[model samples]
Target: MGQNISFNGTTGVNNDTERRIHIPLYFRILSVIEIPVMILTLVALCAVIKSQRSAPVFVIHLILSDFIQIICKLMITSEWIREVDAIFPILPDAFDYSLIAGLYFMACVAFERYLLVSHPIWYKSHHSLKVSCVVSVIVWFVPLIFTFSKYFDSLSVPIGCLIPYPIIILCFVGTRRGLSHAISLTSLKRKLILGRLFLVLLTYTFLIFPIVIMWFFSQIFPQFMFSSFSDVLYFFSHLMFLNPIADCLLYLFMRPDAGDLMKSVCCCCRTDTHQNSTHSRDEHSRDSRATFACCVSVQNPASHSQTACSSV
Candidate 1:
């Protein structure tokens, strides 16, 4: 968020020259790109909600995080309708802080994947519905704890944002070991799984990694880095334009058979209800017949247990 540090502390284009260089630049980048990201998030959200499976839910969260980042970028890039920037000293910083929340969303997705692939059965059995809700909250909160001040400059930039960088950097782009458990497969299954891995790696590289780098550069050489890279970085910044489009394409179009695990829970619940209802009816009928037989035996002393039956 560092700018040319005008003689005045208020942020603005220093002059027509600087304005030409930077004003409306990053905003333009975000405005053009965010539409697609929003679209992708909605599409993926639909797919995941429809199925409620662990994998699809994770995908939805990732898309949502991307969407939020897109919004932060788009909002910052948007030209003000009035004199807000003149009044608000921290507008740009606000947008950047929101974007930090977006980064945490991605980290959550990666961790969820780790659980799903690393311990599928455990995730399926013990990672209850409540756990999902809790994790979602923590994902957003953890990043804020780490990066909010850095994003806002409301406080001195803390060191935690720096610590995660190396971890994020060292992450495997291609997963030779994404999943430890076996996914049932046919001849073509392995190929499709590999292809999906490749696409995921590409998405991380094309959309995520560059943004992180730009953030790094912006921090290191705040003014010059943003000034020099502003044009291309704003436009291409981790393919901001591609997110929604890719999200819709990959999540909805590509994986039609994606099952929602939540729905499975519902279905199972329904079956249990039906079985219990049927069992209760059978038990009631048996009790009624036994009572009728007992009465008949008392009255006529010749009731046959074999023929005992209730009319109802």
Candidate 2:
């Protein structure tokens, strides 16, 4: 007597023990495309950070997460002998959790910007570098716990969706509000930053939603998990990986300072190095003189007395 089995509607002649997990060829191809894009994004982000004196810590964290995800994806998509056991026991879970954690960081960044622009006084008073570092640790750690838990897939999904999705929606609404109220040059710049951020979030959400929907269905109906729909899921999964590269491009175009840094690296319209050095020194001296003048004005008792008298 013989028993027949099928998985995802595809029938194959193999014993239960012979059945093994395998990655599709197309999925592996998509990963190959994603890897180079991520590498380029990482390089661009590094260049931006190097040139900027006060780059956001979140950007650094985002890049690190992207790098880790790329590595994990490579492992997942690599060609290998399929065994009844997991090919790499840890890569799949790590990939999902790390990606989700990175999404949390992106949400935090959006929220921080919203606060900074909408409530500048409060943001300045409450924001701390040390506190940001602590929060980053918490963000990365929270997802890992779920990944390692017995209910890994079933439990992590809803929380992952709840946290970042609403936060990003709030960020979107808050930024719009901030833009409407903004009048000053600085405020306008903040609006631009928020606009770029909104684009990044929106793009990420759109690309990842297909996978989320598929995952939601899969959890409830395990039979549907790796069906024909999986081919579509793989495409979206690759698109989701493109978010980091999208982020880099968005930063380059939307942030003027970062654009200038990239341009400088490309040596666009290059001038003589000696002339550039001389010009920088001159600019520094002019800034120093202006600062000294401002200090002198503040130090003058006569000016202070005159202003006090005039006010009265």
Candidate of highest TM-score: 2
How much lDDT does each candidate structure score? Answer: 0.50, 0.62
> TM-scores across all candidates?
0.56, 0.64
lDDT of 2: 0.62
Query: Any runs in candidate 1 off by more than 4 Å, and if so which?
Result: 4-37, 40-44, 53-55, 85-91, 151-175, 178-200, 214-218, 221-312
Candidate 2 residues 155-268, lDDT tens each? Answer: 454357446877878887887787678776464465456666776577667765665666565556656544356556544554676666655455454243744565575564
lDDT of 1 by residue, 1-312 (tens): 345331111243233455544545644665566666567556656665556544445455556655654554444445462346563444444444444444444444444444545556786797755677677666666555544454465222223333434433333332336532345543243344444444544555576556555555555665564444655454444354464454444463236453343346568999999999999999999999999978878887433533464422
Which residue pairs in model 1 clash with each other?
A: 27-77, 36-244, 37-244, 40-244, 51-260, 52-260, 52-261, 53-261
Kindly provide the TM-score of model 2 when superposed on the true structure, using C-alpha atoms: 0.64
